[model samples]
Target: MSVLSDLLDADWARLCLLSGGGLRPRLWRHVLSPRFAPVLLIRTAQCLHAANWPRLAKLPALVNFVLFGIEVPPRMHIGPGLVLMHTQGTVLGAATIGANVTLYHQVTLGAKDIDFTYTMSMRPIVEDGVVIGSGAKVLGGVTLGQGCVVGANSVVLNDVPVNYVAVGIPAKNLPPEAERSHEPTIDQSITM
Candidate 1:
């Protein structure tokens, strides 16, 4: 899907809230809104980068840095439907991020330290539906598995198993539950 469509699809919950649970929102109106401005800048940068205009891509990213204090480098590969909640002082220098990822303000997804020579390989890969809490720092080349929930201010340096909740200064996964009630199940043979 196009970035706009993917973004809107991912941000359905926010759209519903913005429209007071009305029908789906119009593209230009919502994406351009201040609340979604950070995401917009990221998208713009990505588009510019994809279009082989790295120099031009820096413009929106620069604006994003100045206006939002958010630093999501154009090199970062992010899936659609990002949710940047309370997204001030957020830094996304990760290698890859999956769909429907939600990030709170002050979250850092980057190298372990000030590695000037570090490449994208040094950054973390956050998978789909992961919720990173405020002030969380997920560093290193670890893969944060899909559907994981990271607690606030946690520092993660290792791979977190899928669907587990990791918390603390150096994050550690909690034991898995017997069954997850929050997640939906699917069966192709079943009918609604």
Candidate 2:
């Protein structure tokens, strides 16, 4: 799908999420909210980039970076249903992110090296339905599995399995039983 279409779909998904999946709100409601400014701006940047207008894309991108303090490169691949909850200090630095990914405040998808000489595999890959908690840092070439959850203030330097939760300073994955019983610290709707 086109970037604009993806953005619209994502916006609708978010609206559904916000409405508790009861009623799908009108498009105007999604477009006019100040809370969705960061998302709209980011989606616009992605659209501009995909249209081969990197020079033009940087304009809105810079605006988003400044206004929301979030930096998501237009080149990065993000599927639809992307939700950035509490946009403050959120940085989508990953090489690839799948659909329905929810990110909270102060989340950093960062590189472990200072330069690109380390190879293209140095970037993070976040799969579908992943929820990265606030103040979490996912560094290096780790692949976070689908439905994985990173706890707040955790630092993930390695891969995490599907449907699991990683927590603590260095970030250790919890057992399957533990994950089933534990509820993440964010809205449950985005887990779709």
Candidate 3:
């Protein structure tokens, strides 16, 4: 699909996520929301970079950084339907992030070590329908499985299985029955 199509889908998905599946938000309402503005800029940067306009891509990225304190590289691969509950101080350096991922403020997903050069092996791979809570740090080349949840302020360095919950420092998977206890209150409507 074209970048514009993907961006439009993303915007609609974000609106649905934010509005609790009630009335569809108007274009101006979605565009004017503070929370959605940074996401739009990031998406624009990603599209520009993918189109081989790297120099122009940096403009939106720079604006996002200056306005929201969020640093998202134009090269980062992110699927549509990403909802950042709060944008400030959130740094995303993932190799590939799948669809319907929700991230709260102060969430950091990046290299575990000092690797200035970004590579698949040095970054986190987040699967679809994942929710990362505020102040969480998911480091290294770990894979966060589909539908899994990461608790706030946790440090994850290993892989998490699908539908599981990871909490605490050096996060370990919670028992299947205990998943709901750790998951945040956000209503995740995305499936698959």
Candidate 4:
């Protein structure tokens, strides 16, 4: 199988392990499966810890917790390549997330109200390759355009334009020249 296929298979296997009913064998399978390495195991454990340890504690939930690093309620639909950098404190509401999205720590993607009375009440729809920074909150039926960068600690209450950078309490788009000057460089030694 190709790498993507392998990842998809692993993701499916993980989902089955997490939400499925069987207990002892599932746990054993998760531990003994050669498909899961040490890093994945540790990350899975952390996701379980964050998820308050669901009943049956199936492998799928563990996989979702570890790989995606977002606390996606089982009902939520998420596409593949959901990269979670610093997965801790990320909460995904009941919404469909697209593929290849990168989320940092402390991001929230939830609805404003549980009651369906308001027509405007809805969750955020994250598009592909959209990078959300730490502590950013995208609330209420907003569409994050593709390849947009949400700056750290920004509160995004409006739809962001594609390929733009948003930063502030109520996020505003940065000018093209200013955005160009704000390229972030990473040190390989640091953890994502």
Candidate 5:
């Protein structure tokens, strides 16, 4: 599919429409109506909150709550078409996230503190089309490049390159070119 089509997919667009309350709605409308440049920021925050984090599989029901008081730390930078599937209790620290990223529930993109008063010098940078799975904790100054997929419940502390899939506690990359053949495909072969 085309980039624009993917970006403006019906599911994502619908999520954007239902993000915030009075001010949030106004702001979101203003951003989306004109196709604003910084619309990605709103999308990122809204998706992260709406994804029903901390709850592995109950996202769609949570989207109806009035998300007026949620805190999306302003230190983070988010991109467009970001999908937060089951995004509850997700905390994003001072980091940069690229376009079309997907984050699952209970994901914490936080920083390690060097001292009681000082946060670590580095933070995470998530590139385009990256998928961060449920209950994953991506800490420190790791840079995940384009198309990287992080598996569920993984804890990431190292850098990952494009098209690689990382899993486990330290989040190591799968074997080279493993993602191409091992991509997750949910089958409905046992249809009702």
Candidate 6:
């Protein structure tokens, strides 16, 4: 799909996410909201960058960084339905972020080391349906599995399995919900 279509899809997805919380969201209102400005600018920057206009792309990117405190590299590949819950201090240096990913404030996804050279192998690859909590740092070349949740203030170094929850300082995966079944209750009574 074209960049405009992707942007529209992302806006709609964000609207749905907001409406899920019981607040009716109007498309026009959402489009004009300051909260959505970063997404718009970032998408615009991406569009410009994809068109081989790096110099022009930097304009929107610079605005986003200055105003929202969100640093998104123009070269970063973000799929549709991307939602930045709160953009303050959020830096995205991922190789590729899949569709329907939500990232909260103060989240950082980048290289583990101080490599100024933006190499794909040095960044994280976030899959679809992932929700990274606020203050989370996912560094290095690890892949965050689809449908996984990374807890707030956690640092993920290793790969998290699909549909698993990763929490704590050095994040560790919790067993998948399917494997966490409750034991059956047994009735031990003598019937007459």
Count backbone overlaps in model 6.
0
| TM-score for each of the candidates | 0.82, 0.84, 0.86, 0.58, 0.57, 0.87
Give per-residue CA lDDT, model 1, range 1-192, as digits (tens). 286456656665554554476656556667566657777788878888887888998999999999889987776788876878766898898889998788889999889868666487788999998989999999999888899999999999899999988899788887457654555457633644
Query: What lDDT is reached at residue 159 by model 6?
Result: 96
TM-score of 5: 0.57
Model 5 lDDT at residue 21: 31
lDDT of 5 by residue, 95-131 (tens): 6888777777678776755423325357788898888
Off by over 4 Å in 6: 21-29, 181-192
Predicted structure 5: lDDT:
0.60
Candidate 2 residue 29 Cα shift, in angstroms, is 5.0
Which parts of model 3 have CA positions greater than 4 angstroms off? Answer: 21-26, 178-192
Clashing pairs in 5: 51-86, 51-87, 52-86, 52-87, 52-88, 53-86, 53-87, 53-88, 54-106
Q: What tens-digit string does per-residue lDDT give for candidate 2 at 109-142?
A: 9798764443448889999999999999999999
lDDT of 3 by residue, 1-192 (tens): 377566656766675767688547447567666778888888889989989999999999999999999999999988888888898999999999998889999999999888787888999999999999999999999999999999999999999999889999989888567545654444653431
Q: Output candidate 3 Cα RMSD.
A: 7.5
Residue 26 of model 1 has an lDDT of 56
Question: Which stretches of model 5 miss by more than 4 angstroms?
Answer: 1-11, 14-71, 114-121, 176-192
Candidate 2, TM-score vs. the true structure?
0.84
Instruction: Name the 10 consecutive residues with the lowest summed lDDT in model 5.
Output: 61-70
lDDT for position 128 in model 1: 93
Checking candidate 4 for backbone clashes, the offending pairs are 14-59, 14-60, 15-60, 17-58, 17-59, 17-60, 18-58, 18-59, 18-60, 18-61
Mind sharing the TM-score for model 6?
Answer: 0.87
lDDT of 6 by residue, 1-192 (tens): 376665766666665675486435346566666667788888888889999999999999999999999999988888887888889999999999998888899999999998687999999999999999999999999999999999999999999989999999899899787898565545433331
Per-residue error for 152 in candidate 2, Å, reads 0.5
lDDT per model vs. reference: 0.81, 0.82, 0.86, 0.63, 0.60, 0.87
- Return the lDDT, model 3, position 29: 64
> What RMSD value applies to candidate 5?
11.8
